[model samples]
Target: MELVSLIIMVLGLAALVGIYVISRVSRQHSPQKRDENIPVLRDADGNELSSVCDDVAARDGKRPSANARDMSDVMMSNVSGKSKGVHQPIADAVALPPQLVLFIAADIEAGFSGEEVLRALDNAGLSFGDMDIFHRFVLSAQGETSLFSVANGVKPWTLVPEELVMQTTPGLSMILNLPSQIDDGDAINDFLLTAERLTADLNGILKDHNQQPITPALRAGLLAMAA
Candidate 1:
């Protein structure tokens, strides 16, 4: 029994020694590395340790590419709540009746309602000019309307940047004629902003007056005015 116990202890110690020998050999064979089993390079005198990652890695990690940075900057600029007050287009402002007529004509041609046109205009903050008039009034069966038709005959609603396709209906519904006393000389800052204010002009009148709720498309359009 004494011999058996001694043998067991000696075997345990021998196993421990073998493990230690293996660990030491492994450490010696594979030196300490930063990561990925790749060793850090030592400068002369071993003071400065250079990593596997180079200056390119540092740059890629820190700064975006020029185009990416520009796009990011522009996008950030768009929604940064900058006040673009009442930016009317340089075109001659047309009268409300003519504008209404044009809107009606465009809607009729597009198989949409006057309401949709009005809402889009409000969202776009667009106004009427000769081109605007022409587009709204003179399209054939499958044609687009002018920016003026989209805006509800409001002055200074003319800062609509071009390229807004005369979409059929607003995906979102908004109240165009919310009871706000806006003047002719109202400094719009941004038409869409005014439109949102107009849309919010509701207590009971909105449910009673507007049948359709504002569509997401129109909401997107209004937000797009900032862009």
Candidate 2:
């Protein structure tokens, strides 16, 4: 009886060992599973890094290329607020006041007296109160009709150097300071006739501030002052 029980115990032990061997062989012959320790790549901003290639390559200790590094640098610069963009400049705007001015330059011979201009204005039935040297001449008209003047040129009151003083000589030109006080074509016609007659008497050529001949174009523009 004891011998039979020992044989049974041996057979049971061998069977357990055989089962353990089969399990070990099956495990060894089966596919091996690699342990992957993927790193969550992120900037200092705590964003997760992803993508199969980047994650796998990073685990394998492989780095990106030069262009990739440059792109990363640009992205980092933008994230860090170190990048810049194209900028533009602004310009100033200026406005001019609603003041109308007209000029009638003249061509007088040398040695022409300024007093002759004064006489021409007087003959037009114009009167004066004060003489502003810078404004050169100002003649008052009847009933707020208009105030006019005949000066060397436009803004004749401007002081010139002795070398440039020839520009201010009488008979060189005359500027008629005509303010748009009358809104009638007859008034403009009368003013033009008076200026024309005076300029004819002085033997001066009638021109604009630019010394361009006063054509019908100029006359039509001046007519708007009366309107």
**In TM-score terms, which candidate is top?**
2
For model 2, residues 59-87, the per-residue Cα lDDT tens digits are 22433221122322322333233223312
Q: Each candidate: what lDDT?
A: 0.30, 0.39
Q: Residue 99 in candidate 1 has what lDDT? A: 9
- lDDT score of residue 195 within candidate 2: 64
Worst 10 residues of 1 by lDDT: 96-105
Poorest 10 consecutive residues by lDDT, candidate 2? 89-98
Please state the error at residue 219 of candidate 2 in Å.
Answer: 2.9
Q: Clash number for model 2?
A: 3
Q: Report the C-alpha lDDT of model 1 over 121-163, residue by residue, as the tens digit.
A: 4445444444232112224344542221232222222223342
As for model 1, its CA RMSD to the true structure in angstroms is: 24.9
TM-score of each: 0.19, 0.37
